[model samples]
Target: MDQAVLPLSPTEQETSLGSIVPPHTADAYWLTPYGAPGAWSTNTTYIVGHSWEGRASPFNNISSLSQPGDVLTVTTAEGPVHYKIDRVTTEYKDTLKDSAIWDKAPGRLVLITCFMEDLGGKNIIIQASPLPAA
Candidate 1:
């Protein structure tokens, strides 16, 4: 006989914004760690920042998403991994260095989404240090 698969509990279902992706999106193309499942499916990401009023919106604007402290786990082209969170602020959308968040840094993880509000709006950014080796 085949066993049944139960759904994840509410607490288990909760995940960070960086890990959550739009529904129906293909996971293979996502900028997440290889070998590991997608962040949204695994719920490995955690929420570090929140709106000033502490309100949580599932689909918040980019500005509202970048509160500070958000985190993300990512896979590098070299196959290494890293994490990052907001450490500094620059011009909203016009900034060029924003992409630097993904570059190899001392940290092992970096979180990026959107920020501010503009034609394309700003992106939420995060930079996280890697966890110690097991």
Candidate 2:
């Protein structure tokens, strides 16, 4: 797809992982399907994208180069919200739920993407807490 990831709300009954978490296109980033944005609450905001091999994807940096202290800003209709990285790790794709990154606790940003060129082989997770007052 040529379109980029856009931030939009999902349907109330949107529980299918396919529908809730659309396949990442070359141009777009997908926000979490359930949680409200960090601006709305201390709640977590999840985002997933693909690390398109040899291509420019929105999350390529996060997948390949991000560190524990790096900063990321996500701009929503509410405005720009800042997040300070707290953790970065790699996990096998199938066991993502077993990781602490799935916590429903407040005040978190989870950036998930394919590890290297393998979409299902591995995943790199970046967890961050919302910076004080974006």
Q: Enumerate clash totals for all models, in the order shown.
A: 21, 5
Error of 1 at 103 (Å): 2.7
For candidate 1, the 10 contiguous residues with the lowest summed lDDT are: 1-10
* lDDT of candidates 1 onward, in order: 0.34, 0.66
Tens digit of per-residue lDDT, candidate 2, span 1-134: 13334664655554333234445575454554546556556557777667777788766756557777788876667777788888888888666656666567686777777777676688888888788882
User: How much is 120 displaced in model 2, in angstroms?
Assistant: 3.3
Question: What lDDT score goes with residue 36 in model 1?
Answer: 30
Compared with the true structure, model 2 gives a TM-score of 0.76
The candidate that achieves the highest lDDT relative to the unseen native structure: 2
Q: Compute each candidate's TM-score over C-alphas.
A: 0.34, 0.76
Candidate 2 — worst ten consecutive residues by lDDT sum? Answer: 14-23
Count steric clashes of candidate 1. 21
